[model samples]
Target: MAQTATRHAKLWFAGQAENWALAAYEIDELHEGMEDAGKYHPTHKQIKQAIPELIAQYVDQPLTALEQAINAKNKAEFIANYDKLTAGCNACHQATEFGFNVVQRPSFNPFANQAF
Candidate 1:
């Protein structure tokens, strides 16, 4: 989950930087990670059940919105919803009592060697 979240953030940052290709790749990865985590992780069912309906929507909604934005090549909408997606992630973390793991708009890529 943490890895996925970090990748999501990186991708969101990439989108903000207008690196659409990297953003698109990361978005796909984030979706896959979300599905995998919900289905096969040890805490799978528990995690799913614990997610409140609104939070669940937060998870689903932004994913769809981000995909649309990417498909349309809409940078402005992508950035806006990217922030929403980041907020949703942090909100879920806080709701799950992982507030200390707050995610933010990344200022720098941890993967410095990777060009996005």
Candidate 2:
């Protein structure tokens, strides 16, 4: 059951990676899905390690920090953080032995002028 839930979480993470602006609720649901899968599993453990930034981004005030980064006009730093998040996705895929299944990185963010 844990592994099944983990698989589902992986799916959510994959979709989230593909389009983060789809819905903010998806993020916490993904995290909760991962947590519900158990902490002992490798992917869950990796998620435990990887969630701080996510928490920061969603719960721990990631958007404000993003605003600060943007305010500073530091596209590089933003990209670095975005890359860090992507690395987490890669880390989990690698740990799950699906390393060949490279997760797609975000391209052309869909948040600029679209109605949510």
TM-score of every prediction relative to native: 0.80, 0.38
Worst 10-residue lDDT window for candidate 2 reads 58-67
Per-residue lDDT of candidate 2, residues 67-108 (tens digit): 344345455544454445445555555654547755444344
Instruction: Report, for every candidate in turn, its global Cα lDDT versus the true structure.
Output: 0.75, 0.43
| Model 2 regions lying over 4 Å from their true place | 1-23, 39-79, 107-115
Question: Model 2: clashing residue pairs?
Answer: 55-60, 56-62, 57-62
lDDT of 1 by residue, 1-116 (tens): 77886788678667767777878888998988877665654353335443435346557788889988987879989988888888888777766667788777776667776666
* Winning candidate number (TM-score): 1
Q: Model 1 off-target regions past 4 Å?
A: 42-55
